[model samples]
Target: MDEYVQLLADLTEAGALGEEWRGAFERAPRSAFIPDTVWAPDDDAPTGYERVTKADAPDAWWSLVNTDGVVVTQVDDGRADGPGIATSSASMPSLVATMLRHLDVRDGHKVLDVGTGTGWTSALLCGRLGDDRVTTVEVDPAIAAEAALRLAAAGFAPERVVGDGLAGWSCAAPYDRIHSTAAVRRVPSAWIEQTRPGGIIVTPWGTPYANAGLLHLMVGRPGEPSHGRFVANVSFMWMRAQRPHAVVEPVGVSDHRGPSAMDPELALEDVNAAFAIGLRVPGVRYEHVWDDADPSGTYRMQLSDGAGSWASVRHTAWDAEDAVHQSGARRLWDEITSARLWWLEEGKPDLHRFGVTIALDGAQSVWLDDSGNPVA
Candidate 1:
């Protein structure tokens, strides 16, 4: 069987591809949107990616395009001197299907597809809801131009715009559904403002500590807060403007040293704990450092606010309690520990139990179970 057929079968078995989107997926084959040159993950490579071209390795290129994994199409924002960080990509097929499923679009419903990327998603939306009803936007001019060309080649042409996706396309204001391929640290007010009452806005939302979860928000009447819960766990590249600040390692003298009763593993082990901690403790980035030379599973969980505050909790196999060291004005370890304890007190609610409310003024309030019970 062909790669496309196999992909469809796998998605069907995995329940990621819904019947409503089956026809659209078939019509919009992923390979058509993928560029001839793509980047594949390689630990040995400088940027964790090694470039592969269709001319050099046709089979590898085809395999990458057909699989459920993401294909890195552009890196370093298409700059020559910039470090090779992934700036744009064709997201995983399963994830695309899942996002579309959450979008819950229907006939006559208009959609604004953010982060056009390779334009595969825009093509699918056009296939499902007609080209006229779909509008796609990309921040990078080069990516947008390439996507427009590919969309036309694939016989799908939705309204394409070259601009920041955070500012939703307002010319076609008040869409029935707004689907974002990129993740955001904060749900843009423009998205909420452009979505009509009772419409849906599905985007990946998360904190700097976590890349994120799929947010499915239902638009309320004007002046009311748009509310929604995280329906799925997803990690997409952050929207360019909203990407997290570069992680800075903790440096300099330690201000406080003490033994903490909490295990460092608790924060990283559970998704619920991580999500809750991320929501409770904002602007903190986390990393786990391990010593491969040691056989024991010993590591340190480091937290930094990227300002001056930093903390480290040493988890040793010999100790029941981890040793905590903190410096700079704020004690990040303390904040994280407090957040973890709060999560436990709340019965360790599943990540889905967490919800967010976006007010007309764009102020966001995260809650557990109900909107009245804020995460704070």
Candidate 2:
């Protein structure tokens, strides 16, 4: 069997791929959607990826494409000589399958696919639900055009629009389901307005502190709240409008310094802890930077509220109490420690146990176990 087939087999064995969607996935092989020239990770480059064209490295390119890993299709939104940060990509096949499974699509159901990167997802939707039922919206014109061509070439043509996915496509309103490939900090009210009551809206949702967890919200009637729990851990590029600021070195003098009893690992390494802490500490972004200059292994876990507030906790290999420093308006370290305590007091629930409710006015609240018990 070929690599693509092997990937499907692997996903099936891993329970990521459901038998109901197997045919759709088979029709939409990832290799067919991946571009000839894509980006691969490079340590030396300032941008995470260096370009790799199929012409120059066919074997490597094919290997990368057929694997279950993500294929970066565009960089810096396809700007000329722009930074190499990935702006669009064909997500991991396993993740794609998992999202589809969570979507719970049925016969005659209509789907609005957001962030049509390579159009692989649109193709799969079209194959399963028919071309007339799938409408995909993409923000980048060039990326959308390329995806259109690929979708046509693959013999699947869904209605494709080049526009911000946050607004969604209102012309085809009251969809049965809406799925997003990108991550969002907030669930747009338009999505709720466009989806029929009892419809499912699956997307990667998170705060600035965490790029994401896969959310599967069940839409309520118009003017009512939509609620859902996080089903899985996922990391996707933020929606262009919701993208957080890049981590930069903290400026200004330290406002306060003291010893911190909390371990930096909870914030940096524990995904569940980070997700819960993020709900408590909104607008916070963090970076764990290693001190390569030091002979002894040490790192600084820094947190910034993206306003004037910032904090840093220096950690050594010996597990000694770290020194915490805070500057500007908010004592971010103190807030995080308190949030961590809250998380621990609540039994440190996993991400799956967390849910969110979006009111009609677009106000969002995170909760544990149920929507009635909002996270404080």
Candidate 3:
């Protein structure tokens, strides 16, 4: 208990854990939830626990509880031996605290916690609002069982369910607050449907092209889509069903045919333009790789599909000659160039000005505001 208190102090000083969050940390000894064989980045090597022999090595396990980063416990339905790929894990203590702070959980608020990884967050919620006032859901049965055991060990057991967190636990409807631990590309209708009209839903969201930003949306009418603004930048694994297909690099660039391209300076600008265009036209996937080799180097732009579409500019040290190749989806490149031109013409507005609106019909649109009117 003393060790846990010291750890809570360390996390509080680091701004990872708040004074209000200290009670939850004290109630839940993170060591009980974590497995014996856990990966510790602080140690020179990975550490394993002898659960049966010395199950009471409080210091060894407690040290791991305080480390940053998610701790992987089970993989492949908990069937794989050794440390399998961390399919799910208890989120970092700091991130958990941050999310809770954003949630603004009060004494009597009813909350729905989605993606109850390891039940640590569930325990925290229970510590705040009492066990009966919180309901948590997890997709994996094995993980849910482990989390339940851990929560019970901490003497703060909440209602735990094993099912798709995206659907949410409607049995506990009209929650004061609904928060998801996982990143979502689209806000699920079920979440808005279950939340009270004035409740809050905080989750990470982004288009296919950009990194995710934390979105704090207010629940609107029963059937209408929620509205929100970007709060902060965050990264999390997409929901299992929402994961995008693996991207494949293009093939046979030498065989592609196209017109002579422009100089490398223009090509660099074109790549930047492509990214900006993606902001306007979502689902356009592209990658830009730059190579350094004397005056002559390659600038490659490959589409999501394995199609070799690129524009290369080569030159000699003395500026004697330069060759170019422009191939595959020339029109896409044209659109990118046009968007860049628009930005330049408009004083190059900050990307933060862009906002998202989810429609009732399940279509999401990004708008650039100019005096309260959408520009693009």
- Candidate 3 on 51-125: residue-level lDDT in tens? 321256556555556666566554534554644334566677777777788787778889999988778888888
- Please identify which of the two predictions, 1 or 2, would achieve the higher TM-score against the true structure: 2
Q: How high is the CA lDDT of each candidate model?
A: 0.89, 0.88, 0.64
Collision pairs in model 1: none
Whichever of 2 and 3 has more lDDT, that candidate is: 2
Residues 8-91, candidate 1: write the lDDT tens digits: 999999999989999999999999999999999899987788999999999999989988898999888888667778888998
lDDT of 2 by residue, 1-376 (tens): 2988989999999999988989998888888888999999998988878788999999989988989898888888888588777888989989999999999999999999999999999999998999999999999888899999999999998999999999999999879999999999999989989999999999999999876699999998766788999999999999999998765656657568778867777665588888888999889888878767873465788888778888888776324444787888889988988998999899989999999998878888889998878988
Model 1: residues with Cα > 4 Å off, grouped in runs: 80-83, 250-254, 289-299, 317-322
List the pairs of residues colliding in candidate 3: 36-49, 261-324
Ranking by lDDT: 1, 2, 3
Per-prediction TM-score = 0.93, 0.94, 0.71
Candidate 1: global Cα-lDDT?
A: 0.89
Candidate 1 structure, TM-score to reference: 0.93
Instruction: State residue 276's C-alpha deviation in candidate 1, in Å.
Output: 1.1
